[model samples]
Target chain A: MTIDALEQRLTDLAFDRPDAGRVTARVLSLARKRRRRAVARLGALAAATLLIAAAVVYFVPAADAVLADTPIAGDLLRSAGLTGAGNRVTAVGAVASSSGFRLQLVGAYADSTRTVLLLRANPAILPLGPPSLDPQLSDQFGRTYHVQSELTDSRTGQVIIEFEALAWPDALTGARIALKVTTLKRACASAPFCTDPVSSEPMVRGSWTLRATVGVDESTPLALPAPAHLGPATFNFTSVRSSLATIGIEMSVKGATFDDLQQRVADGRKGTPVFTIDLFAPNGDTATASYSLGEDQRGPLIQFLGYRFGPGNYRLHISYRGSDVDRLLTVP
Target chain B: MEAALTLSDAATAALTPDELCRRYAPSVCRFAGMIAGSSSDADDLAQDALLRAVRAIHSYDPSKGSPEAWLWRIVVNAGRDSARRRERTRWIVERLAFTAPRESESVEAAVLARLRDADLHAQLRLLPHRDKTLLALRYGVGLDTAEVGAAVGLSTDSTGKAIRRALARLRARLEVTRP
Candidate 1:
């Protein structure tokens, strides 16, 4: 048969279309259940945090001295290792209100490899669950960035969203940043086990825009180790930069093009021969490569969140086609 | 109100839950049915995908593509996850000495009942999973090469080449099977 004929046949395959009204009702009903569950979980977490805070206050007085004015922001910055030197902080205090809610861009923190925006909501627009902010960000150089990770304090409606700056390492310094957010969603508590939002909880719609200029932080590049080989691929580690939120690794892969590697990764998801890279911390904890920014003549840049990787030696593990290689590396 | 909004219109406008269900539910159902190879499973897949889209709507940047493309990407990923889950279940069932029903067997039976091309359907099942997905997106869902690329995370040229290669492979297999 001709391929076109086969296509036509496939298109003609018969199946009964689901009833839209029934599916809608069922989805909305399930969404309500999910929202209620999220709220309950949030309540339990808040109670747990309060108890921990009380105990910490009573037992450890030194912790209070290190906390920023906003405890949530303080904790986030501290965990990200952004409170130390080589980090630049700018106070914007830009505010906007709409749809019965108020939003403020409190400030921004920039390091050599990442930019983090701190935002606060008055009257707590998001439900007592995980908050989802979809803000479109663009810099003066017209380069856009996506949110790499976000942490929200539901009780205070305080949020810290991070973006990778490795693509244009020098462009963020002293650049005007515009952020526009039109809707706020109550995101799923966790991925893969996620559920729909409550039908009653429509996405909060409003236009909130803020502008700020990022300060300069000198980029500090770490020394790279020797190339690691696996099967037919030679991985040359070109550059590694550590920031508060993530460690960016730029490497070139010889003997495999970007598309080939991407296809291999996709096939790996299907129980086939896999290709993966992982970074292990000194404490034996590990973080897998999260996402790729893009590729240039050098190679694709991969990033791993610096959550588990404190100041110590790390082990870089590469697995491909049943072959495994581990090499010791240090992140300064 | 549901009938008044086109898919593109829904993309630029604020998407309500009602609007989302009305504008895209049937298409999503059909697409999910193709991926799942079973109508019953397709309903569940469509529901899961829609639920995810609603919750992750904030991540949808219009500059990336149309809302339809964004939603279909979610559908494709959801289908892949479902397939992996089924594979795991099948592995467990086999270990326990239970006869697991093949997804293709259901597809063959359904095609025999609905269309006059059961042989072709059988051959299609023999193709790799990615090839089947590419075909389903391009032919079954009526997505163009660009939309297929957007959904599957490939460039337009790469998508076109992949689809052509998949078609050639399917044709060779069909010829070998034919009298």
Candidate 2:
């Protein structure tokens, strides 16, 4: 059949129309439950924090020393600065073995915006090189989360996989999460330069599923200033979500058409705008932008990871084409 | 409440979650069904996309594009994710030598079976995921090239070229499958 004929047939196909009211009710119900859970979790965390503080005075030193010895934990401590971030990290100790490989879900550090899962594979799978891991994550609510990026530490054979929820039910606190990995194929022959695996490479073809309960972390939303003017664009700082692990900034840019934004994205695969955002901690430490999560007409949502900002004010400096503006932000 | 009010602008105030679902859920479901090849999968995909849109409604800016384009982008991502999950499950089943029954006979499969165009349906199914998505957006959802490009994060020219290429591939596959 011709393409036009196929298109016509597709348009005429008998597709079932779902009940809009039912769908909307279901969506709203889930959203409400998630919001309620988040609020309740925050309250409980506050109470728990008081109790944990007394307990941590006795146990934190030993715990820190032990974590400092491990390669993955040391890296996490340096990168995310998750030390003593109350209940932000969970120790999952679930293990599954398949096809001569033992995989352990060591633990996870989660905030409002993302979850970083620490997994260790026995037999040192990464000593030779990096491998492509096909992992699928789903929670008790049947909400699936996508893996944004994966970092492997060859020294400990541990994998750090970061997940971002692109839909509702983003709250993972106290929810049962199952992570299933079906295949692990060697993607590269070398350590740093990992390319696609050739067909001849050996592939591990079995399933390893680990389940864990995610701990809660504080995600505080900061009050943003009014829209700022940058040449040819009006940048409205819509929202700023801060947590120990990451800070997410959402803005809407006016006076720039969607085509203009798309062209800028085309010019740079990073898709970041022609501007820079810098976060300066109270201790003179700085955290750089982690990723630019794609921009649309609504503007770009950027994430800054790593650098622990204690309960103090931070300076957010923005620069666009030689013009600079700074805003002081408070982190509770 | 105050934070919500501060976040509200002309773009977000224009459409609430209730209005969005009431107006666009049907079309979203239809588009999802076409891409997922099953009504049941479509239901799940549509719900996921709508809930995502609702939670993220504060980020929607009308000046960026039409609400339809914004929502369709969510739908497209949801569909792609579902497809990846299905592929993984299929891979596991094949590896285990397990004969898992089909989730359900998809609407497209049923219609093609009735019309004795099962070969054409099979050919369509064999197309790459990206090609199928483009075809579904352009033909199944009746989106123009520009709308499809907006949803998929491509330039209009790129979207048009991709759709034409997908059509050509489908035609070639159908020819090969014919007796």
The prediction achieving the highest TM-score against the true structure is 2
Candidate 2: tens digits of C-alpha lDDT, residues A210-233: 999875565778888545444455
Name the weakest run of 10 consecutive residues (lDDT summed) in model 2 chain B. B1-10
Q: A8-98, model 1: which lDDT tens digit per residue? A: 6777866454566666655554444322111112245435544543344345433322213463456656544455432356778888888
* lDDT scores in order: 0.59, 0.59
Backbone clash numbers for all candidates listed: 0, 1
True contacts kept of each: 0.23, 0.37
> Whole-model lDDT for model 1 versus the true structure?
0.59
Model 2 residue A117 lDDT?
A: 81
DockQ of each: 0.10, 0.14
lDDT of each residue in B15-84, candidate 2, tens digit only: 6566677777777766666566455455566777777677777776656777778878988887776676
Residue A273 lDDT in candidate 1:
30
Candidate 2 wrongly placed segments (more than 4 Å) = A1-71, A80-87, A125-133, A166-173, A186-202, A258-273, A293-307, B1-179
